[model samples]
Every structure is written in C-alpha cells, then in structure tokens.
Target: MSPPARARPLSKAAFSPTFSKLKTSIYTDSLRPSAPVSSAHFIRTLSWNAPGTLIATGAADRTLRIWNPEKTNVKNSTELRGHTGGVERVAFHPVNETELASCSSDGMVRFWDVRSKAVVGEVKVGGEPFTLAWTPDGSEIVAGRKDNNLIPISRSTLTTITEHHQPVQTNQCVFTWDGSAIFLTNGDGCVKILRYPSFEHFYTLNAHTSSCYALSISPSGGYLAIGGGDALVSLWDTQEWMCVRTLDKIEGPVKSVDFSFDGSYVVGGSDEDNKLHIAHTETGEYVYTIDTIHPAAYVAWHPCRYVLAYSAEAQGLKIRSTMDVQAPLNPSTLFSVRGLLVVITGGGTSIGLAIASALHQNGASKIYLLGRRIATLEKAVETLKSSSSAPHYVDVLINNAGVIGPRNGIELHESESISQLRGAMLKDWSGWESTMAINTQSVFGVSAAFLPLLEAENIRRHWQGSKVTGYGNARHHSASALEKIGTDADDSRLAHIITVASIASYIRRCAAGLVDNASKGAAAHIGNMLSTLLAEWGIRSNVGRPWNENNIGGLILFLVGNGGTYISGTVQVSDGGRLGVFPSMY
Candidate 1:
C-alpha cells in the first residue's frame, strides 16, 4: 500500500486575528430585586442559539436568562426558572433555532423550546450532570458528570441509550464537527478520542499537568483547544493530533475556553478575578485581556460574528464585540450622565436643586430627593421628571442637607458683659445637637444605607466589586488596549457619592457660627474617610462645596459623568474665584 501523506503546516498569517481592539457595548441583564444584590447568581455556562439572534445562560442562581444582544436596555431580557440546583452547562441544538438544552447539578438534562420558554423534554441522567453537548446531526445528546460517567441519549426517544464509565472524572466533552468522533477531557489530564456509536476508545493524548477542565474545537474542524488547571491552553492541529502551540500567561485554572467564529483566535476563562485571556491561534501570542471584576467562568463566541459572550462568577453574562465599530471620544460621553440614578438630600432648593437640575439636563436616569417635607421633595421630582426621559436606579448619592446652628454673630462692643455674650450663645445651644446629627452624622448614615444599591450599580456595569487599595495589579493594565477602545463599553468606573460640604470646613473665617463650621468640617472629613472605607466596596466618595451655585452643579455633573472616574476621595471646590479674593484657607 502507498504511504499516507503528511499534513501541511498551518499558515501563521492566515489565522491572525482580524481585529486587535475590542469593546463591551452591551450591559449584562439585571437579576430581579428579589435576589439579594449582595449575593449574586454566578453564571457558569452559556450558549448561542443557532441563528445567533438570542443567547441562553445558566447561572448558579438556578435560573436561565434569554437575551437579545441588539437591545440597549438590560431590563428587556427574559428569565426562566425551574432548576433546583446550580446550572452547569447550556447548549443550543445545532440545527433547531428554537431548541436548547442544559444540564445541571439537579441531575437532569432538560431540553427547552425557546419560543415558548418551556421545557419540552428531559432526560434524568442522574448524578450531577456538569456538561452537555448536542450531536452535529441533532439526533443525540451526551452529558458528563462529576461522578466519572458519560451518558448518551437518543434525541427522539429522550432517554439514556447507554453510559460509558471512565477511569477518571470527566470535566468537559464535545462531538467533533463531523460527528464521527468524541473528545472528552478527564481529571487525570488527558484528552480521549472515542469512535462514534461503537463506544470504542480511539486515541488518548496527554494534554495537561493538572486536571483538564475545558475543551473546544475550531469552526473549520482543523484545530482543538484544551484548557487545564495549569492555566494554559494547548492548541492542536486536528489532522495529526499534534500539539502546535501552547498559550500560557493566564493566572489561574482555565475553567472555560472557546474559539472565534473564524477560528483565528481562542479565549480562555480563568478562575482568577479579572482574567479573560485571549490569544492568537497561529502564533500563540497574547492578543487581548478582558478585565472582569470576578473570575470569568464561561466564554462563547458568536456563531457567525466575532462577538464574544462570557460570564463572571456570580456576576452574570456580558457580551463584548471585537469588531472595531465603536465611536471615538466625544463631549457628550465625557460630560453626560445619561444613565446614572442620583439621590440628593435637600434637593428641593438652592444649591441642591441646581445640582439636581444640572443632572436632569445632562441625562441622569432618575433623581431621588430625600427630605422631611413631602411637598418639597415631590415638587423637585416633578420638575426634574417633567423635562426628561429616564429610568429609576441609584448610581450616585448626594449629601446636601444642613442647618445653620445658633446664629451667635456678635461684635466686640455689641455685648457689655461676658455674661451677656455667654447667654447670647447659650440661648439657642439646643440647636447644635440637631445640626450635627443632620449634617455630619447623616453623611455617614446615608452613605452606609445606600451601599448595597451602589454596589449593585457597579455589578450592573459588570465591574468587579471591592478593592479600594492602591491600584495593585490593575494599574499595570491601565495603558492596555481597553482604554484605547472608542466605545462607552470600556468604562470600568465605580459607583460614586457626592457630599456637599462648605468652605467653612476649610476657611478659618466662618460664614455662620463655630458650631456650623464644626459640623460642616466634620462632614467634609467623613466624606474623605468614606472614600477609603468604602473603596473596598467599589464605591467612590467626593466632597463638593458650592462657591457658585451654578458652578457646583456643573462640577457635580462632571463628577458623575465619564470624566470623573479618577476623581474619588477628593474635594471639588466651586468658589468661582472667591478663594483668590478671600484670605481664607482653601
């Protein structure tokens, strides 16, 4: 017999990435308020429907969410709930647009009709089914469990046809594009190839040092990518099952891996926070790194496009695009607060009201006024809402309420005796207690109360929560391609708090009394302190004093907008050149 020909080498230029820059324009869907925002539902797996118009996600919260990527509002997503345990993996049928399947720790592989949002059929494979895949012809399904069993079921019968017991626990499994072979990764760091239907093992390749966790095959059926606990992705040429390249540099075990639609690049989801590593297929060089706030657990590329969908542990699903179609830097994005929800104390009048008006005009999603007077707060909301269209959610909190304590203004000769002066100040000494409580104490109280809401906002934006310390490792990525992206999707800013203190806090000369100055001063200090205290929670705090009521509003608008991301735990003074005129401390 004639000798078989050897496979040709892969061309590096042919498999190079199409785009180097990427952006995240789509926001993740929000969970219902009934789920405590403090405890997030971690999304472990996801899949794209055949047509690529819809996405299916399985979360630890035991619920499924179907999302339309074109929609701008996250609230437009639809949710399905039925699983009793954490969902592990989800896969859409290869040929059916409306059919989807998922496996869960609940011990069942359920098939759903996405059109009706109902489970049409289920196979109780038992054990904790951790991963699932549909056959290329859509005639069968296979599920792998933690108990080292692989069960195959006939699609028509909806029952397990047989079970294959493995020597080691299987972490992931997939059918080859031709449906002639099955590739499964096991706990002993090996990728086993099995012949279809006959259940005979065909080949075994040593793939990783630690347990193998993730597996993916390219669209062209020419390459296979295997991710393992060693934090590396091994790329193999399918023709001869030869290891062509190894992608390293990930910081943790690769939990999920996927190939781009064109098979030019591969992405790895690591167990470490903020690590979504993408590398080139031909050269095996690092191409991009997506900074997620939580450990990235699952990743899937769109069937027809370069768009990528991924899940952050307990944070939910996010969609990012690698197409360079984002807009450039503009004034509207820098100064606008288009989607921020704001809470302003004493928002009914003067400086507080002006700040509210600026936020309203600039595009704040909602303005919440906090005050004892119902009529005044209602009037402020009506005025703000009357002129604009926005939603209700809190992203920024403003502390702007205060009382002038005991107006004890007296001249040197105004009082004849020391007793007269002392009595004048002591007459209304009772007001001091109330002033301190309302002004200084309330700053901390209100900020503490709104913490969950603030952290929730950060989560909604897909930003990792609570790391107020110095930039740490994140600072090294500041100059990365993420900042060069032209879209708003690159925003990783935290939730903000704006505390309105007075010039009295700094100036030795008091506009009112020592008590008023002391309270405002204390409030200012609390604002600064809260920045450090709450940095761990992903909340930012800033103090603003209104030198010119007009300027204070604009300053606050800037603070809440995209431009103010770096101005946390600091003071924003809007004196309108008053500091230059006065001999007071700044």
Candidate 2:
C-alpha cells in the first residue's frame, strides 16, 4: 500500500452553493433563569395547552414554571410550588386553558389553576409517580408509576377509579385521538395499545430494537410516532397500529418526541447527544437540529405557532424557532384546511367527532355535524362554534358516522363444528343485518346526501382563486408570520367525499401491498394497501389525498387552500398494513 491515499479535496461550488446543497435552517431560542441557584435547576418536563399560548415546565428544582412563549424574551412568568420531590411531568387540561395537571418524583399529582397560581386539586399517587395524562374529555386522569401500574383517577375527585398493570415498565403513555384506547412505550422495545375503560389488549408493536422511551400522536389521530433507545422514531398508522416508517439520524437514545402544530415535522430530543432532531413525518428525512446541550425530558409544540418548547435535564427551557419557518416554501404546510366547509356524518361521537374537532381547531371554514340524534349533533356544533374562529361554509364531508354493530357476535370455539356455525349464523342474523346497515350501507347514503355541498365548496374555491385571489382562498392564503405555510398554490381538489371504512372488507389483494408485525419475519410490504394503506396514506389515485384516516382537517385545509385542486376518484386506505399482517381474513 502506498502509505495513505491522499484524501480528495472538497470541491467548492464555483458560484451558488445554496442551490447546490440543501439549505439547513436551525431555528432555536433558549430561556434560562437569570441566575443559577442550585443543582436542582435541571428541567424535567414541558407542557402546552391546546390553545398554545401558555407553556408549563417541571424541573428537578421541584418548581413548576408557566410562561407565555409568544413573547420575545420569555421570562419565568409564574411559578407553582408544593411538590416535595423533583417535578417530573406536566399536562394541560384538554378543554380548560387555565388548568394544568402535573406529577412528580415526590409521589404526588397536582392540578394547578394558572390564573389563580394555586394547586386546585391534589392527589397522592405515590409509588414514584413519573407521568400524567388526561382523557380527551378532561373528565379523568391517568398516572403511571414505577411499579408497572397505570391508575386512572377522576379529575374532579382526584381519586383512583381503577388501575391497570402493564407487564413491562413504561416510559411514556398517551391516549388515542378519540380516547378509545391508551398507548404505552415499554421496556421491551415495543409500543402497547390497550382499549380504554374496557382495558382490552388492542395490540403490540415492536417499534425499536431497544426500550422505547417516547410516544406521540398526531393532532388529527391519523398517525402515532414512537422513539426509543435505538436512536430511531417509528411512525405508525393509528387505524391499524402498523409501523409506517422508521426515522433515523439521531445521535443517541431518543428521550422525548413531538409533532409540530401542523403535523409536518417531528421533533425528538436525544439524551446522550443532547440535541433535538427534526424530521419530515412523511418521508422520514432529516430536516434540522437544535443543539440543546442537555438531555431533554420532553418537548412541546405551540398549538397555533412555529415556536417549540423543550426542557432538558440541567437546562431550564428552550423555546426554539428558525428563520426558515418564515419562508413561503416550508414543507410542513402542505396539508392544510384553511377555509373549507366540512360536513361530518355521525359527527357527534368517536372518529367522526375527532375529525370534526381537528378541522375546527385548525381553521376549516366551517364544520356541520350530521347524525341521527339531533341533540348530539347540535351539541357538537355548539362546542365547535365556541372553539374555532368563524368561517364561511362547511366544505368537506367526512362520512365517518357508523356503528361497530351488535354488541353480541358469534365466537368460534374449537369444539364447535360446521353445523354449529350455520346455526350460530342464523341466530346472529339480526346482528349481521344491523352491522351491514350502518357500517356498510350507510356509506352510499351519507355520500349522496353531502355530495352537493362538497361540489358547491369546490366551485367556490375555483371562483376565489380565479378572481382577486383574496381571503379564504386556501393556498396563498395570507396569514400572520408564525403560522404554517401553505404549499405550491394550485387547487384541483374539488369537492372531496372522504369515506371511512375498516380493514375487515378487503377480500382480495396483491401480496406486495401489506405489512406485518415483527413476529413472522415482520416483513412490512406496501401492497396495493391490502389493508392499511388505503386508510393510512390517502388514496394516491385520481384525487390527491393524505395518509389513510387522512387527517381530515389537514386535507380539508389543503383542498380549500388551492393545495389539492382537480383531485378525485380514488379509494384511500389507512388500515396500518393490516392485510399484510394477517393475510386475507376471508
């Protein structure tokens, strides 16, 4: 060998380097105490309310500080005291902006009233309470302990209603979008999902090679992201809990994770690397990093702005944003529902209500709730009217209202034979008919009912864009500096009728489209979406769509914004590769 081969010199771009290499933007802001007081100053957790204006952080110093991140110089606005041990976690009430709930190593969970700056409710959870989460309705609270126990307590009474024993130790827990289930990251490098209230084991996902430490769900309930000791983040389809993709390039064990306000970028803080990594949720590509210097315990994104808040082990708190966010071409703004009207069937409860809420909160033009129960529909409308800004009309129609069918169904026992099966079918004939009526037949009925409204919305968008290109145009829609940017302005997305279905319907499919759990070779193949793809990644055919389950609000925003123009005639799948995992069910 001739000594060492000379290393090639880095060739300089003769002229413009910016266009040659990808431009990297690092947007970050740090907030620290004026003077360091003690070793207990390490930040442990961070939380933001649904409105995004207020932020709360817990620290080893046993202090909980609340601040307004909107300010240029974020001061430790208000501090709450009472926990004897280090503050471990904080959660804002889903509906109440003024109320916050927190837990600590001191073995206590406290709910604080921001305006009063006092602990309104306190409960002694003990057993080294490390985390806290609120049900979507904010009526109850769940706390995880070091002993592998999950205790759900009433928010009003702050007393344990029930507790569940999760086999593996838990690092984090989160409720699904509709609060139908709770997902947890365990020590076994897996994410476990259990039905809420019923406490049934929904499924388990092998997300990482090592223990998983962080978990987050997108605002629209379409996706779930998990981070772990493997230095990777796995994004999964919420509908079927199938891993969509694995995101890497992290420095060390991922300590915490979060989605940006717009669900475009995913941010995870690394423990050993002491850095915050931001990656594109769709493509799983690296975007930017924020040097945090200390291991971060949690990260929070503002509900409506570009600001991000994270707390590190020793550092106080970091409120980060970058100049790149101000650019008109930011990728995160691609899916938006700026000014589109939405009509959701069965919009009063479950998935229907969840989609309606996501759209309303994110700036849809208007959302109309249609269901059999007039009272429930009216209530939903009232709730939305009170929550979101006023918009013109309901643009998109979410045909999500349907029933799971009869409470009682046929179960197979090894002891039963074909004769028993035939008799059982007859006995359950009524259940079969009812299930088909709601879960199957209703699709046609609801779609036809809302077709006219959707068509009208499309025509309206075309008019707006062709004319002065003014307000409510969706794409190139004028906005304040901090909001998520809209995409390469064009709106062929005319009148969308997003129909929701289940994985149980796929009778045939090509082999390539399905994915599997890690057990049987765990080969995750992207078939013609045998099961989950249709619902996870929106239909890619004639009409442009997002992932299945589709994140209706974001899609509506994009369509209304001139982002999705002239798109139609496609069936989207979001079953999380269920067909791949189980093969054809029939």
- Model-by-model lDDT, in order? 0.75, 0.61
lDDT, residue 197, model 1: 76
TM-score of every model versus the real structure: 0.52, 0.55
Model 2 weakest lDDT span, ten residues long: 1-10
lDDT of 2: 0.61
Provide the lDDT at 529 for model 2: 25
Model 1 stretches astray by more than 4 angstroms: 1-22, 26-40, 72-74, 322-586
Return the clash pairs for model 1, or none. 42-314, 293-464, 466-536
* Per-residue C-alpha lDDT of model 1 across residues 433-456, encoded as one tens digit per residue: 999999999998988888878877
